[model samples]
Target chain A: MFIEFKDVSFKYPNNDKNVIDHLSFTLEKGSMLAILGHNGSGKSTIAKLIMGLLKATSGSIYICDTLLDEKSIDDLRQKMSIIFQNPDNQFVGVTVKDDIAFGLENHQIPRQEMLEKISKYATLVDMMAFLDANPENLSGGQKQRVAIAGALAMETELIIFDEATSMLDPKGTKEINAMIKKLKNEHNKTIITITHNLEEALFADRVMVINDGKIVLDGSPQEVLKEQTILEASGLKLIDGIAIIKEIEKTSLLSKENKEKICEALWELTFKM
Target chain B: MGINFQNVDFKYAKKASHKQLDNVSLNIDEKDEFIAIVGHTGSGKSTLVQHMNALLFANSGNITIFDTKVVRNKKIKLKPIRKHVGLVFQFPEYQVFETTVLDDIMFGPKNFGKTTDLAKELAIKASQLVGLDEELLTRSPFTLSGGQMRKVAIAGALAIDPDILILDEPTVGLDPKGKIELMELLLAMQNKTHKSIIIISHDMNIVAKYTKRIMVMHSGKLVFDGSKEALFNNEALLKEYNLDLPTAAYLAKELKAMHLIDYDSLPLTKEELTHIILGDSCNE
Candidate 1:
């Protein structure tokens, strides 16, 4: 397992409620997993725990089968990177090139290797042209591209995107999704995408629905997204394609097999339906 | 009874070469209007709506809201214009500061010089309009859920009793259900009050299903202004503006390819697409 969490339960110091309650899951290496939940459902807490920004009040978390603790935190953090919802908040350097190189500078990488990594990652995210441009002047999509370049330049084994596309327009979202798919398919990057958007979850290898800090549903998106009742209870709705299938399932004309055909047909459509 | 902008040009700085609103001309009726302004980021959608309430004055040309002239040099009190044009920014929840939901909703009305009793009444009415209950009104706004906090902020806007309501990406961060519920609430409010609504959004689906008129902005220029149906049918224009076709529109195109539906014009709503696909065999 690349990452594992066992019997995790956490509560804020002043609060009686456990924000995350008795959660257990393991993620395989090189697989993409999406975490879906309503606001205040402990999704962000899980991300924080993985980033070692918040210590697990109980239970254990292991990276590469090594237990996560204060002693291993610095080393573990170097193995993972996180991109937040807002790129403006994550950007640290004045220029895109400097921002991408900021992490390597922390690692004290030699100047020659740092320059090569910066060029490689910037080219990967299609931000090479704007390497010298001010990060503030870029569009939301472009800024996200710069952030992705920075994250990728870190060369971490695991990357967590916490609602990274929430602030973007649809075009911007599509651009980011394309990059994520590339990263997963071509580069074998392990990913955890935390979002409320069901459509985003459709691209994942596995999907987990979190409610009240527990995993209520976990499976392939095809299986988990069909559970309309659970999705509704968790304050989520199906994507447009799945939603249309659900509505079609209500009719007498289409059989179970035909409904499945609609799902496949809709999924195969070049454009989003 | 409407807002009119003519040859309006605005720039953040006088020395800035590019104009934010380049000769923008548009008319928005005060009654029975549901409009959506859509474009990519930095396309001047936000700048356009900010002008509706005199929040930003054009550097050149003219803007008339209802009957008052809006100009950069004008010293007239903008409170009256702002009173009739309530502008809700993205994430209106950040504006909620009152201890209780009721007090938060009443703040706008009270600031507008309504008596405490009248403000309370308006607060109750606005909360009810947004589907917020009296019980929640007494609780701390901070304690409410994200959806509820958003409602409280919207209620604050409604408490001002604006004739025209403008919201910037109102459903940006909401979940799917939350997005639909908020949009439906706005539709219900529009139905009950007949108030004009202007929404700046990138969700083509919401724009297609809810708004009657569509305004396309591109690079700080108004490119197209028309009905949603017309906008969806214009593939070339949609591509030029970097806008995606709504799902309903895509479905229509696919159905046409399959020889399932033969309508000359594309459909912009799910129901219309369903009718075409199911061949009117399913009951409405």
Candidate 2:
């Protein structure tokens, strides 16, 4: 496994109940995993645990076959990066170019190599034109792209997005979603997207619904998102695409077996229209 | 008279070059209207709505909400206009501060000089309007769930009894079910009170289903303003504004193109789509 967690549990110092209770999961290399849950369901806690910001009360974590603990903390840090919800809070440099180069500078990459990597990643996010622009002057979507460029430049094995799309408008959200798909298909980057948006979950290779500090459902997006009961229990609903299909199924025309194929056709139709 | 804007232009600061609202003009009726403002972020939707309550004075043109007129270098008492136009900011939880949910909700009415007893009466009525349980009134607002916190903030706005209510991205971070519940509550409020409700939303489906009128903004200008059907049918304008078509309309259009469904017009709701697919009578 590229990353593994076994019976991990955690509790805040002031609270008696554990926010994460005996949670267990594993991720393979270059896989896209989406973590979904209602508010206060310990979704963000799992991301913090995997990033080593919070220690597990019990059980173990392994990264690339190395046990995760204080002894190997620094080594584990080099293997992963996290992008938080608010892009403004995560920005550290004045300009887009400086921000992307800041991460490489900390890793002690040579000056010549750093510039090449910065330009390469910036172009990947389509932000090469704004390299010298002030980060504050950019739009919400542009700022997020710059953040992703910085993360990609680090060349980490895994990246965790913590509700990164929650604050964006629909257009901005769609752009970021496309970027994630490209990072998975083209760059072979392992990703863990933590979000409450079920539509985003539909884009992932695997979806896990966490509730009450435990994963209540886990499967591919096609399977897990189809379970209406589980989705309602987790304070979620079917995305509009699937919901429209289900509505069609309730009518007399479409059979259950043809639902999936027809739904895909409808999506393709929507795009062409 | 209703709200009117004429060639409004606004900038955030004196040194800022980009105009947040440039040559903007629109008119909103005082009652019997549910309007949706759709746009990409920083497209001047917020800037335009803020002018309704005089929170932002126009730098170049004139704005008249009811009888109050606001313009550059003009003296106008904004309190009366604000009393009629209630503006709910995005993430209203940041505005909550009172000890109890009831107190928090009553704060708005009290700020307008209502006596405590009268404010409490208004708060109770607003809570009922939003379907908040009476049992939770005494609890601290901070102890409630995110959805409940949002309801409390909305209730605070309702307690003011404004003639017009405007919300900016009210459902940004909520789950799907929570979003529906909030929208339903807003709809019920509009129906019962006959207040003109304006919402700034990015969700095209919600806009198609809820509002009769749509105002599309791009580059700090009102690019399109008409019925939802007109807005969806204008493919070139939608593309230029970078807006996504509503799910049902887009699906219907595609199905028509594929020759899969024989409907002449696009469906704007799931029921309409289902009817066209099944070739059944419009039972719904």
Candidate 3:
């Protein structure tokens, strides 16, 4: 496993209860995982813990087969990058080109290599045209694309998006989703997306639900989302395609075989459209 | 009576070439109105709503809110107009700065020149209206949950007793259930007060389920304004405005394409779509 958590638990200094309660999970290299949960469900906490922003109260975490401790923290951090919910808060440079270069320069990359990497990742995110544009002048979608370019320019193996699309409109959300797809399939980057938007999770290789700091449901996206009652209990709803199919199943008007065929077709059409 | 806008045009600065609001005109009643303004990002939805409260004056044309007229280069008392039209910004919870919830709720009333005692009375009433627990009113607003903090911020707006209440992207970061609960709370508030309620949203599902009137803006232009049914039914208008259908309507259309279900009208909610599909099979 590229990332592993074993019986990890965390509690804030002032809070009595654990925010993450003995949670255990693993992700293989070059796979996309979607973490779904409601407000205060510990989904964001897991991301922080993995990124070494917060120390785990108990248990162990391993990154690239090395234990995550204070001694190895700096080494592990170099292999990961995180894009937060607000694009404005994360920007450190005045221009898009400077922002992407900020991360590359911190790692002490030579000036020539930094420029090449910046242009390459900027073009990959479709932001090459806006490289000279000021971050303040760009739209929310454009700002997020610049953020993605910065993250990719670091060339980290693992990237985490923490509710990155919740602040955007549909157009912006769609743009980020396209980038996520490309990063997973073409670039083979390990991805973890923490979001409440169930529709965005439909394309994930694996989906997990967190309820009260515990992983209550985990499996393939289709398998995990099929548990309608469980999902609702965890403050989630099925995606529109699976939801329609479930409603169809309740009415006995269609045969079992026909229902199965319709389900497959509907699922395919959902993503295609 | 109500608020009226005539040929309103606004630009951010004198040198900026593009107008943020271009030749806009509309009317919103003082009572019993539920409307949503939607468009792509940077399409001027926020700029349009800011004008409702005199936060941004028009560079050209005029706005009549109740009886006060807002025109360029005219000096008038803007406080009364702002008092009658309350605007809650996006991520309102971030604006909560008072130590206690009650103090936060009372800020608006006090700012409008109400005495402390009267402000307290109105604050308590508004807190009750938003369904916030009385016990939580004394607790620090920082300690409350995200949803509760949002309710407290809304109560602050309600305490001012504006005839028209507007919210910008009120459910942006909330969960699915949280979104539904907040929308329902706003609906109940509208029913109880009979005041106009306008929200700026990007989620078509919320617009279709809760709001009656839908306004679409494109490049700072008011392209369409009418009922949800009319807006969703017009494919060319929706495409031109850069709007997408509600999930239920999209599902119904896809099912029709696969020759599974046919409907005379698109369903805006899952319940409506299920009813149409089941009703069709039963008739067959």
- Higher-lDDT candidate of 1 and 2: 1
User: Top model by lDDT, which number?
Assistant: 3
lDDT of 2 by residue, A1-273 (tens): 889999999999888898999988999999999999987889999999888999998989988889999999899989899988889898999999999998999989999999999999999999999999999999888899999999999999899999998888887787798899899999999999999877788778999999889899999977886787778788876665566666765765565545555667765543333
Q: lDDT score of model 3?
A: 0.90
User: What TM-score, computed on C-alpha atoms, does each candidate reach?
Assistant: 0.94, 0.91, 0.97
DockQ-wise, the better of 2 and 3 is: 3
Model 2, position B25: C-alpha lDDT score? 89
For model 1, the stretches where C-alpha displacement exceeds 4 angstroms are A253-264, A270-273, B138-140, B260-265, B280-284
Restricting to chain A, the TM-score for each candidate equals 0.94, 0.91, 0.95
Model 3 lDDT tens row, A1-273: 899999999999988899999988999999999999999999999999999999999999999999999999999999999999999998999899999999988989999999999999999999999888899998888889999999999999999999999888899899999999999999999999999877888889999999999999999987887788899899986666778778888879766766776677767776665
Worst 10 residues of 2 chain A by lDDT: A264-273
Q: Model 2 chain B, poorest ten-residue lDDT window? A: B275-284
Candidate 2, CAPRI quality class derived from DockQ:
acceptable
For every candidate in turn, the CA RMSD to the true structure comes to 2.5, 2.9, 1.6
DockQ, candidate no. 3: 0.64
- On residues B223-248, what C-alpha lDDT tens digit does candidate 3 reach at each position? 88899999999999988877889888
